[model samples]
Structure formats: structure tokens, C-alpha cells
Target: MRIPNLWVNVFIIFVLPNLSNGQQLSTKPLKLTDGQNGVKSIPYRATDQCMPKMDAKRGKTTYGLSFRLHSKGGHCDDGLLICYPGMLNRHADSLGFKVKGLFQIDNKKDNKVNQFCSFKMQKEGISAGQTHWRGIKVYTMPNGTENRQTMLEASVASRPYKLGTNVGQFSIHLGGNGTDLLTMITVNDGKAFIDNQANLQKQFLEQFWNGAFLREHTGLWMLGLDLLPSMKQENVKLFIARNCNCTMETWFTQPTDSSDPKEPELPTAGSNNCSIEFESTSEATTNKNDVSDECFGEKHFEIRFKNIFKKCWMKFANACPNQTELIMLTMSRRNGFENRMGIRQTWMNDSVPGEVIRFLIADAEDGEANDVQQKLEEEQAKHGDLVFLHGFVDIYAHLHLKVYGGFKWQQSFCANANWVLKVDDDALVHLRRLAYWTGKKFRPIVAQNPLVFFGKLYHKYLPIRNPKSKWYASKEMYPKDMYPDFMQGTVYLTTPATINAILLHSGQIDAFYLEDVVYTGILAELANVTLSDQKKHFKWRFDHFDEKNGECEDGVPTPFSIWGAEKLNVFEHQYGRMKSIECKK
Candidate 1:
């Protein structure tokens, strides 16, 4: 089912409660000018004092109050905790919050998130004294007001939080049965953990205030995490709010905001400047599974690459095991730091594809710039070989491609290839099978519905979540009911000539964030190339299907792509066992 996009907000409140030894004293609430000397504070012993109607109805053993700061001006230019009648809590040493899941928040929207602050409180009981409020310090704001936002009705339950070692340990894993969002974090003085509802409302509210918004709104976005154990904290204090001007264009309609009513609608299908077809070797290579294109150039460039590589390899005095080479290139210097290390080690190892050649154009010769150069140079010397270009020469869209422009760097290296496969560093390649499969054919392996697996299928998004996700391409951005079958840029294959054509044609195409989707899917759409899916390219849940015919969960593993390394290792062990038995024959 095709899911529609929607919007939501998030907030993160970390509270530290110290009610150990004995009951503590309640600190005097800071006076506000709303016609009150001191604010009426709710003690920790009170049950259901703060009602935050959470999407998830789960919590802990004990309960307490914590108050999240609502910046008076809608934006938190000044760090202050203006108290209202919510739960009271304190911010731990590591005062940073992180959000991760199927939902993504754009950190670029608003920068005021860096200035907001909050407080921590412990639960009150019959035996628990007012002294319990001692460790709970009340931090006053320098320049902020209290009545900015309202507290929502939510769930009630308390659990111990680990504020020291496990304070910053935060992770959110999405995808599960029904619509439940689950979270697990370390708590209880490092002795145990708690699985409860992670204030997703608060998460979205923070994102909303910071200018980050959600995209899909059909299903509910769930969060599961273990609380940091230290004080008695409740789930009801969680809430989300946004002060930025809301816009449909900012959420899902447009890439950038504009008042032009004549603005073009999002393209559902068609090719653009960023799309191209690589050399396919033969008409059959391009015709596999009904994938066809006129702009791709009917002339297959496979033989030309084989002919060129035959000479280059011979000249270099190096020979690939079966004349199959995996040519990899990196364009941006920033990507070299963000993901290159993991990419090279996980996907470029010898057991996967034959060889992975990394090409970089060093912009500077010294300083930290040189350090990046030095690090990459050292990595190449240690892991494999590096190709360094002297200065600024734009072979591809260096500025726009960011992390996805690596394939554009393979132009000169196209000579040594039976097939050329382009993939991003973040993708975990299944090298062995990919190499073996590419050796058997020259046609591209595309998906029937690209990004669908990550969208409505395996990892689906709900409508109430943040609407500012990158995946929410509207009709103005895409025109078709669904994406044409195209190779995921994370991993796509072509003939050597096709690679060269793509390299040359890449100039006509403007660079995009996810280059693979832009080129193989969007660009191919315009070029009239029919994208076909190689069923084994993606993974389905084991229980979601009835049988496992040695399909390796998703499909065959390519040494160049990312697969579950542990699972792959287990398979390799089993393969070794089977191979030994076959050798006995």
C-alpha cells in the first residue's frame, strides 16, 4: 500500500532524581509575574499528578514530576527553566539528546534548540520527606517566561534512571509488530535496564521547535528506550510543541519555499540532468525483465571497456582473478571522514569484490585539510591503494553530491571492468554474490519499487510523525503512482562503457542528496529506461514469508554491499562445511 506523508514534532527531557537515604525538602518555586508569588508545585508522592496522554501506554515502578522549559519567545535564545504545573526534573552532566529511527529530523531548520534547558525531580511519598527535594536543584532562567506552552495529559509510572555512565547512551530502533514503538536503555545504577515509552511527543516537539519536522502521518511513530537510572521519573512529563511558521512546502510539498503558484508539480516519473545509463554490453543486457531506454544509447559500451581494461591491466602488470574488477571512487573530502573508513573496511575487503580503488581530489596540501589528506593517504597505504588528484578539478558535482557522488569519480578507472557497480559508503554490500552475479550478466539489477522496502514495506512510517522527512516526495517532486524499477544507488551494476557514458552524462545532471535514487530512479525515469528488479536485491522478514529456499534472507550476498556481518559469517562457516563435504567427493 502507498502511504501518504504527514507532520509531527518531538522533545527530549532528561531528568536526574536523587531520593536515596531519606525523603528530601521541596525547593521554593521561582516567583513569576503572572500574579503569583510562588508557583503551586506538585510533590512526588502524588499519583497521576502530570497527565501526558502518550501514544504508548507503558512505564516504570515509581513516579515523580519533571518540568521541561518552554522558551518564552517560542524560541529558546536564552537557557532557562520557567516552571509551570508539570513534573520537575534536573538536567544531567551530558545534556545532549539524540533521535534515531525510521523518522528523521532536519537539524538545519531552527538553531534555537541549543539554548533550551530543563529541571529534574524525585517522587514524593508518605514516608518520603520534603528533604527529598534537596538534591533536586531548581535552576532559574536568565531571560525567559513560563506560560509559552501547555502540558498534555499523559501516562504515569516511575523508574530509576542511571545518570552517570549510562546518561548519554541513547538509541531508537524502529519497525515491529502492529504500531507499537519499543525502546530499551541502561538504567538502575548500571545494574539493569527499563523498556518503556520514550517521550516521542517530546521528541517531535523539540524537533518542531528546532525547525526539524516529520514527513509521514498515516501510522503512529513509536519510540522504545531504557531510562537512565537515578531518580523516580514518569512518562507523563513528555510533550512536543513547535513555534516555527508551518508550511506544507516545508513539510512535503516543495524542496524550498516559494510563492510562485506556477511552480511545477513534483515529477512522478521522468529523467533529469542527474540520470544516465551505463554500458550494457548487448541489447539483451538492457532488455532484461523489460527494462528499456532510448536516451541510454542503444550502443552497449561493454566491449569498449573490456578492450580498454585489457590493455590497462596488462600495462599495469596486474591481473584480476577473472578479469572482474570493482572500481570505487570518492569525490567529496567530507565524506572521507563521515563514512569512508567503515565503507572501505566492510565493503572493500579482498574476500568481497576483487579490488576497490578510492580516488580523492585533495584541495589543500597542509593543515587539517592536509590531515584529512594524510589520514586518507595513510588508510590507502594500509588497506589498499589511493589515487590522489592534485587540486580543484570538478570531475563531478563535488558540492552537491556530498556522500553519494562517489560513483562519479570512476571515469578514468572504467578501463578495468567487465561490469561497473556503483554504491555508497553507508551501504553494506554483499560482495561475494554480487561479484559472482555480475560476472554472469551485463544488465542492471533494479528494484520494481525503489525505496519502497524502506518506506511502506519493512520500515513503514505513520502519519502523525514528523512530516519533514526526505522520503516525503510529493506529486510536485514525483508524478507516478510509484517509482519505476531502478537500481538502488547504494548498489547498481552496469557495463564498462555504460559506466563511462554515465560519467560523461553525469555533467548534464544536477547532483542530488541520495544520488542513487536521483540517477538510477529519477534520471532513468526521464531517460525512458525501464528499471527492472532483481528480486534477491532486497530483504523480507523471515516470518513474513512461508519458505526459505536458501535465498539468504534477502538475496545472494555481494561482497561489496552491507549484509548482516554476523549472519554472513555464520553462512560462511556453513559454506565451508558444505565445501569440505563436496571436496571429499
Candidate 2:
């Protein structure tokens, strides 16, 4: 059965003098608003610095090309290459810098005359995560005569390289992604160059984002190479993503000078000259390590800042039959009657006595052709599990309200429940396994005031600036490049105290449409909520793209306590497998 939602937001603005451990909370009430952050979203205004990239119109189209490097006895004898791979600027601004996607310069005195050659190959239009090989070109000075000449160039790999002396050529990459231009490789001879300094890496990265090197509001990538002179050769790589905020990691052979060959320090992922609230994550003490980071590839270590939250959720559980130990608040649409019925007959029915499940729906999301509200009332009369919320339109953008409202609802009424689970109506929750894990894992921690916030963590992520994206965030809304680590909002678990912390903190910051990012990430950081980081224990119940691809073979029962956001038929099938004694976990 479900609880009704004719409830008002309760705010205890007074200071708590009798707080546990003599601790006091002086906090305000959560007042969520859609901060009129979209005045110029039509023609967005950017108040922050932007990155520079290749200016197509500002830079002339060269008529020629060349690539010549001198290698002797398996060692590079000459070549000096400096390639700044940047975005292909479509803007006609005078501040833009002209760069050929491919170029080569002969700095070698052995080449007689100091020759500078530059040209364009193909228009830069590659996408992120794709590596391509194209025939590149550049116009060179030829001999000492500065007339004009064209010479074609070559690339060892997709990466741009420079050997030594005046014997080298420059190579650049162009990408379809705004923030990502190309994957550039710079090979240094291990000298006293500015690029070798760790701080320079940060500066170049800064120039890449701020308008210092490009036009305002632009976000692009910059690559700097600082190699140790001692190492014969090393291969370092970085993969850029859509938001240009992927975790940077690599494995390389030690440079020759082992003493000072430290990993090059990079600017915090997605961070630039500007500051946002809690822009960088302070590390949190978790009992588990990140099992999810494997997706980023091999890394010796990852930088984690300190984020220590005060442990709060305490022992308040007794095995009383009527005592509701867990509250599963499923966010549902007002007209999602079919989904509700599907869940009721599936995982929702797999509940034990101490668990309570309710579907939360916004009042505004109801019927045109059908009387959704009346049918919901009838459904409530039959099931008694629907909680209707007021005061917000149920559009996709305002979905974050579902989180904030649902959490507010949880804290106000179900504070006594040992744990609170938030799930989507499309999600799958293995109540039986959750019940087992509660006793085996979660209960003990809850007994001692668990510092638990469980869900899959999206570690190094950047907010998208492209207006075409549904998740687009403007500078007025979220000016920061990186969002604090947030969970995939499909499902998450927390205790009453954590919810209180989040709610209070939510009152302190401006709200955004992306609820998981604002509440789960932004508020979660301020609340100091550390993730459970048990990724293998929680996952996505992947469905095949084609249902026709599915066979009538024996179904596999999922062992996870939660794996979610599934379709109706898949939910019913999985639920059947969960009940069948013949299925293996």
C-alpha cells in the first residue's frame, strides 16, 4: 500500500541545541526554484573565459605541403615541431589565430635555409574517440628564396611528433566536437623547454579553455608535450569525450632521468580559470575502492581530494513486524498507469513485510483525452500506493523536481525507516536480495550510523555547453566545467540524516534542471555524502535493441540488489526469473 501526498514542506529553521554528540546544525529550509537562469538561453550569454582553436576564415588557405625529419642510428638527429591542434573556428572574429591542420618546418641548419612550410589537408571534421589517417599538406619556403612551394607531409601514427633540430614538421587534428579538436602527440628531446614544466601543462590547458588563446565562450582542447630527456621514448595518450571531460590516465615507460620523471600534472578535468561551488571534489573515505574506474583503462593511481563527511545515520531499527524499515520511493508519471500495473505484478510484489513501496507522481502530468487524475484516484483506491505531489509541471526538464520533492517527502514522513531507496518506475529492484544485503551488509552499517550513499559514481565528468544537447547547461545556470561526482539517477539509496544534509545544502545553492547533478552531485558534495562505490553490486539491466533477437532460452536471474530503468515486458520476464527456483543467481 502507498501513502498519500497532500503534504507541505516542513522546514525547521531553528538551531538544534540538543544535537547528538553535542553537534548543532544551523541550517535553512530548502526552497527550490527554477532560477530564471534562461533569459539568454535563446542566445546564451557566457560570463566566463573560453578556449581558442584553429580559425578557418582568419587563417588563409595555404597553396602547398611537406614532412621531412632526419633520423640517424635509430636516434632523431633533427626537427623542431610545435603543433597547437585547435577547433575549426566558424566565427569571423579578429581575435582568432590561423593554423593549418598539418604543417612542417625545417629548423635544421643542415637543410641550408631555415624553411617554414604550412598548408591544409582536409577540413577538420573528425569526431571525438575516432582516430583517423589522412594525407596532410603544407606550403614551404623551399630553398632560401621565400617565393612559395607546396610539400606533402606524413604521420607516424595519428599523433603529431617532433624529432629534433630544424628537421621536423607540425601536424594538427580537427574534430567535429567543439571542445575536442584532435589527439596530438608532442615528442620532446628531454630539454630545458617550457613545455617540460608541470605548471606549463596547466597553463596550456588553461589557454585551451579560456579565451586567452581563442574567442570567448569557446571550449577546446590543447595538448602539451614535456618528455624526460633520459627515457629513450614513451607513449602517452589521452582520450577526449563529448563533454571533453573524460578521466585522463595512461601507462608509460620511465624516462631516462628516473629521478624527476613524475607524471605531468593536468588541470582538474573540465576545470578552467573560473570557479563554481565545490568545483573540485575533496576525497571521501569509503570502505570500498572504485570498481567502476576500470572503464577508463589502466592507471597506477588517480588523484582524489579529501571530502570527509560526519557520520550520522544511526541505529534505530528493531525487527517489529509493523515497523517499516525500508521505503522504496519510485518516481512515476501521472499517466503511467500501465507501468505501475506492470511493476505491481513484478518486482514490487517481491517484497517482504518490513518494506513499503510507493509510486510518486506529479499532479500536473495528467490527462487530455482521458481523466488521468480520476483514474489515478481509482487506482489509489484499489492499490493505495500512489503519492501525488503538487506545485510543479512534470516536463522532462523539471524531472529534477522529482528528486528534490521525493527526497523532501521521504525526510518528512519516513524518517524512521532505516533506509530510503529512490528508484524510477522503469527500474528493477531485487527486493529479496536487497533484504538479504540489508541484513548482511547495510543493516550493520545503519546500526552504527552508516556513512552510506549507494549508487554508481560518474567520476570525472564535464557538463555539456552545446545548446543542441538536452542536458545543455548555460554559464548562467552552471558555469563550471566539471560537476562534482554524481550518481546515475536511475536508483540511489540513503538514510534520513543524509537526506536532511542534502536538503539543507540544497537550500544553500541555486537549483538546476538536472536533478541528479544538482542534488546528487552538487548538494551531495556539500553534504559530504560518499558513494558506496560497489559498482559490481549495482548495474544496468541491459536490454537488447531488437526484441526479435531474444530467444525462449532459460532466463538468467540477476544477483544484484538493484539494476534498472527497464521496459515493461523485460520487467515482467526478469521478475518471473527471480521467482523461479530453477534459475541461478
Candidate 3:
């Protein structure tokens, strides 16, 4: 099965309950507004009467909420809590770089999130002097006027957050998984470290450190979102809130009844200026499978990264083990920070002998202007096992460019390796099992047949013309209604000759978006290459064609060379179970 792409991304700016005690960072400076005389503002820490919804139903924890400010009819408007800092730049005790904005989350579904928000603290509660996490007193019957219940008050304690950290839940945050921080501080970027090296989260948090305190620690009511009621539609407003603590002093921005900031447009069609839209979503999990693009219950597609091949700006010299028996080349997402790190720790654990595991991904989808580029740079220097193809981005739309781009790089750099095992970041290659079988079984087969192109092969798969479907292909791209025989990019192994053949014919054909068809099917057919089928050795469960819909489970047998794996946490969670299961005859 093909790896799914998520339309809605998960938030990654949260702190778990009871993990560690976070040190207090700053003190409250000045109040922009006085709520002392009935303005309804107070002081509250993430620890005080806050509800994390940890015990709530599974999938109940949402990360965003918005309501109108001082409007008629007391209705909620589509809004986002923007936690801004005093300045966008802060670090090394000097002025930081980058003009940052408040950490904001944009939730698409309008569900009633039970998460807390800033409101007037009510004295009528069973406890007399109690305030919510936002220092706003709870109201008895209902808080605020009927037309404006979920609203923010002006004070130094309104912690209006921006980015939601859904790392533990869905594994995406700030355009990546929290695991992307490489080496903490790198040898290239000059910066001091705490020496002992805290949770890589500290480095992750430092990305937004200039604009507000990201939730730290495991279980102390790590921040939740607020969902207010709505009356009607109107122009929305935004505020720059701050949370200063060491003593937990949260600050609120003075109310500015201005419309939301215009979202920046992303680059299109050869535009050099790439701007990552601030509204990238996570977790595109629909219940049923979206198999509109499949034919006869099978898929016939792979990525061919076109126009993405530029200069190799970031690379490791001879990182591919010379004359290694197997080379694992993973085509990963640019924002898949945790996936890359998870691969390094799991099956890529050097379990296979004479094999080198290297990840193949570009860093342009999320754009290099922000923290994504910095984290990638650090990860490469620290790991030195990554190959980031420069030039064009490797986005969902650039699938045609990334797959072939990876193979081209391998042909030029790591062509000496015997078997080029191409796989997706979401899939796990049982390195030990692969080695066991290749040496005892298929090694000689590939050694003799240098032009071997093998995997779960498919034939006569038709192109999907559904424009609404994620895998839609245009008639112009591939005029033929049916595709040629090809192997799935999920887990395919190719010899040096096959790689050379595919690259040689790359320039001869017109570029198409669907990668699997272009390279393995079209190009392989053009070069008169071999297409071997190895379906029984792999187990993939793509129940739903959802990117964040991971299928890693317990009690997996060790017989298969590859299993359908997804998500960062599941990879780590099942790594132990995967090792213990013995291959049954």
C-alpha cells in the first residue's frame, strides 16, 4: 500500500502530565490592562484548576478554540488563541532573531472542546478563593454576557497559546514531530548547552521560546484549548499574549479589534519564493478507506520527484557503506522529524549486517525559512546518515519529483551497494529478516541478475481521474488509461543495473505526477528492465488511506521482511514486540 498524506496535521506544542518539573523562567513585568476593578482578569498557572482532559475519551482532546470579542448576541466566532511574546527574538540572553508571532492553532471542526479558556473567576464556587488556570473566576449560572461567553480579558495572566503540541497524541508539531531536534546544539551553530542534554523537547521549545513559554513538564495541566459559543459572523480580532513565570506570570495583550492577519500564499509553478502557509493541518483520518484511486483492490503508483533535483547542498561523504550488501533508502516527509529519528532508533538499529540505512527526503515542503530548516541541518550533522536533495520541494504535489530524485542521488552516490532497498518512511524494513533471507535466499538471485526490479508487482492498474481524490491523475499526464507493470514503492528492492536503467530513460519520457507509474512501470518498461514480484514477504494493512491513520499493532510475526508501520510512537512502541516474535515456518 502507498503511504498516505495527511491533510490535517496534529499539533505538537504540549507538555505531558507529571513528566518533569519545569524550572520557572521569568517574572511578571507590567500589566497592560487592569482587571482588578471588574475587567475579569486574574493569575493562573498550568497547574492550578486546569483540566488537561487526559482522562477524557480517546480522540477527545482538541487543541483550538475561538469566540468573538465584546459583540452583540453573545455568540462565538471562529477564532484562535494567539500567545505572543514581548518580542519575536530571544536567546543567548540577547535579542533573538526572527519576528515571530503568537503561537496559534487553527482547528477545522467546530466541536465543543471542554478545554478551559480565560473567563471571570466566580466566587460562588464551593471553594471561595479559587481561580482557573487563566486566573479567570468561574461564573455560577454562566460566565460573561450571553453574546460573549468564551472571550479573553486584558491582564498579565491570559495564556492565549498559538501552536498546539500534539506530539504524544498525533506526533506533529510546529511543522514536524518533536523528535527532529538533532544533537541539541550542533558543532556548526555556536550555542551553549546545559551539558547534560535535557529532553530534545528543550531544543524544540527553544524554537518558540522567543514568543512565549511552551508547556514544559509531563503532567501539570499542560495547556488545553478553549471553545466558546457563537452568535453570528463578524470580522475577528487577535491579541499578543505572554506567559512569564519561574513564578507562572502569564501576560495578556491589550485588546485590538483588528481582523486576523492575512495568511501568506505559498509558492506555485517555479516560484523561487516558498512560503509555508501558517494553516497546515494534521491527522487526516477518515473512517473508511479512500480507495477511489485503486483498481482491482490494488494500487499502481509511486513518487518520481521531478524538478526537485537541484544541487546537493547538504550531504555526507561516502556515508553509504561501500560494497554494502543492502542499502535502505527511505523517502521521508520534510516535516516528518520524528519519523526519521524513530527509524534511526528502531529496525535501522544496525540489525542487518553489511547494510547501510539512509533516509531520502527534501526539506522544502514546510519551507526552509523557519525552524524546519534549522532542525534538519542539525539532524544531518548529528546523524550524518541523511541525504536531503536540494532545489524543489518534496510536497504532496511533488511526489513525481521526490521518488526519482532519491533514486538519481543513489545512482550517483551509493550505486556500489548491491541491493537498493527503497521504502517509505511509514513502512518498516525488518533489517535482520531481510539480511537473513537475502544472504540465504535472494542475494545470489540479485547478484547474478543485475537488472532485477522486484517487489509486490502490479499490472494494468488504471489511472484515477477523480479530481477530488488525493491521488488524482490527469489524462494529459498519462494518456494511457491503464498503467504498465510496476512495483510498489512501499518496499521494493532493485539492483545497480535496474537503478541505472531507470535513470537513463528518465529524460526520454514526459514527466508525470504519479511516481510509481513513471519510474517502475514506464521507465522500467522503456529500458527493458525486469520486474520481479515479492508480495508474500510483506504485510501492509492500509485499512484507510489516511496518513496519520497508523496501523502498528502488537503480536506481529517475524516472517515478513517488511510490515505496514506508521506514526513515530507506534514504531517505538512495537519495536520491542517486533524483535521478540520469531518467524514461523
CA lDDT scores, all candidates in order: 0.29, 0.41, 0.42
Q: List runs of model 2 lying over 4 Å from the truth.
A: 1-322, 365-367, 446-449, 543-558, 561-568, 577-585
TM-score of 3: 0.45
lDDT for model 3, on a 0 to 1 scale?
Answer: 0.42
Q: How much is the lDDT of residue 372 in candidate 3?
A: 66
Candidate 1 per-residue lDDT, tens place, 1-585, comes to 212221211122222233233333323222121121122333331111112112222222112222222211221111112222112112222223333332432221222221111111110111212211111111211111111122111111122222222121111122122122232222222222333234544454455545543322111122211122212432212211111110001010110112111211421111121112332222122222322221111111111111011000100111223454666443334334435555444444434455555544332311122245446544544443333332122223222232222333344334565445554434444456555665443233322321121111111222121236544434333334555444544445544444433444443443333345555654554544444445454332223322222334234332223322233443343234322221111
Candidate 1: lDDT over CA atoms? 0.29
Ranking by lDDT: 3, 2, 1
Q: For residues 21-101, could you state the per-residue lDDT of candidate 3 as single tens digits?
A: 444223222222111212222232232111222212221111122211121111112122232111111221121222112
Expressed as tens digits, the lDDT of each residue in 58-152 for candidate 2 is 12111011122222101111111212121122211111222221111112222111111111111122222222211211222222121113222
Q: Count the backbone clashes (under 3 Å) in each candidate.
A: 101, 38, 57
Give the C-alpha lDDT of model 2: 0.41
Clashes of 3: 57
Candidates ranked, most accurate by TM-score first: 3, 2, 1
